[model samples]
Target: MESIDRRLVHALQIDGRAPFAKIAGVLGISEHTAARRYQRLKERGIRVRGALNRFRLGHHAWTLRLRCTPDAGPALAQALARRDDTFWVHLMSGGTEISCLQQVKNPDELLLDRLPRRLVDVSAHNVLRGFASPGTWRGLACLEPDEVAALRPEFEPEPPTELTPLDEALLGTLEVDGRAGYADLAATTRTSESTARRRVEHLRRTGVLELRLDADPSRFGFATQARLWMRVEPRSLAAVGVTLATHSEVYFAAATTGPANLVASVTCRSGGDLYRYLTERIGSLDGVRETETAPVLRTLKRVALSEGEAFPCHA
Candidate 1:
């Protein structure tokens, strides 16, 4: 995309409600051009939507790293990509491990109970803590306007899903800005503010939509994030898993089939916090036989759609 388009994307990532006129002004383009560019981007499988800070909303988000056989890599990855429960999946470096994110109503117990049964060679962890930031398109942000325009035809989007008209419209508005006002949503959905509010409530109740604050880990003082892996006897899994899940510092956890039966992603405000969690929290847990850790140095792709008007796992 053009530098102007990148600027527009950045603006939207910061505030999805940024008016087209403002984006155009910032990019020295016309509002119509800005609008067209955004529509085009959406057509190209680039999602511009509201990302909920689910944790703040009383839901827990966990990243699960899978260690599967090389032969099973593609198969497992594809299976996960097609599952609605998995928010994102990636073949890690060397393709030996796959990383994924799961948004669960609760992260502690179910995460552990579900993994061994979910995939053949899955290793699990409730990441004690980790850092996260809203994904931006700066990398894909360099497309020129002409490039974006030229690519429009090839970028034809899949038709919207078979949702109610209101559901379809609400998804569109929320895709543009998760934090949009009820009045704004009403205008977009062609419904009254009260109706829009009711629609949003319904979406939430049905688990189709989640709204939350998106935080940047570095900005939040979690410069170092690591998934702490632990091995526990099957009998101790439940008691230990529940304890770790409810701990504020433990962001996500799950059970796996590997040596480290339990895995956790952890975040700390400082090095001191990290030291305390490992020495105090983790070390204190019984039935943990051995432990291993992998620090997430960088994350390439965060999440994707299993279905809908978003990025489909199929090519």
Candidate 2:
């Protein structure tokens, strides 16, 4: 990717709904050039999609780590991906482990007690707090400081909003294309364009809706991805999590229940890159007592739905 293209990706990460003209202005390029570059990037599997932050609406999220028989790992990963309740399904630790994030209001939805065939072990950790995610990751950053400020999303206090059927329908279209125009959104949700636009704003204001940029980290040269599960001293847990959230290599960091108090997802350029990060960065952090690194051998599902390409090897 060219410098301008990377800038565009960075801009979208900040505000997925940012206008192409606005992006072009920040990059000091023609609007058409910026739009064209984005289209090219889209062709390369980059996308901005709508997402629902159910956690903000009193929903609980759990991260599951499943260690299965080698032969069952791939099949189990796919089975989990086929369900709408699961996301971020990964094959890791020599293709014998599967990790996924799931949100369910009903405990029965988890079904952990009834392990599927060939499964050896399963552990589910309740996500207590989150410090970072792809939306907050700065690994793809390329814009100058001023340019970043120009694209930052505004924040303001808002009252709690109820989720209506119309809002759910509207979210359906956005999940496929976050940049869908008001007219297209209206057509899908069977409402006026003005109504569609207002509803989107309301959802965003109330923290129920989010527009996220989805792309392969390897496409931007950060190829190696791994999950770092660390046990931190109780008092410094928040401090360590806050620090890890800012690390360029980390895309997801959160505090969770279970043996490890903290977990982080990171991407690096190579094995040496990861080694240096673990030694120089994590090693130097206070209160980090023990760390277990699980390299992601394949990502079967991202935050959203499965990809169009042939499945089985990704991330």
Give the Cα lDDT of each candidate: 0.55, 0.82
- Across 1-315, the per-residue lDDT of candidate 2 in tens digits comes to 777788889999888888888888888999999888888888998988877766656666888899999999998889888776676778999989988887766656775865686888888888888788878778998888999999887867476467899999987777788888899999988899999999988888876777788787899998899988899999999899889878999988888899998888899999999999999999999999999999999888775565211111112
Per-residue error (Å), model 2, residue 227: 0.9
Q: What are the models' TM-scores?
A: 0.48, 0.93
lDDT of 1 by residue, 1-315 (tens): 466655565555544445677667656789999888877656654444543333433455555677766666666666666654455455643555677766566656344454433344554444333322223212223445653443222222232223478976786667455647789889887899999987666665443454322332443346765666678888997677667755655544655545676666565666787788888888898888777765554333333232111111111
RMSD of each: 12.8, 4.4
Query: Quick one: RMSD of model 2?
Result: 4.4
Question: Which candidate wins on lDDT?
Answer: 2
Looking at candidate 1, what is the lDDT of residue 314?
Answer: 12
* Model 1 lowest lDDT segment of ten: 306-315
Candidate 1's C-alpha lDDT?
0.55
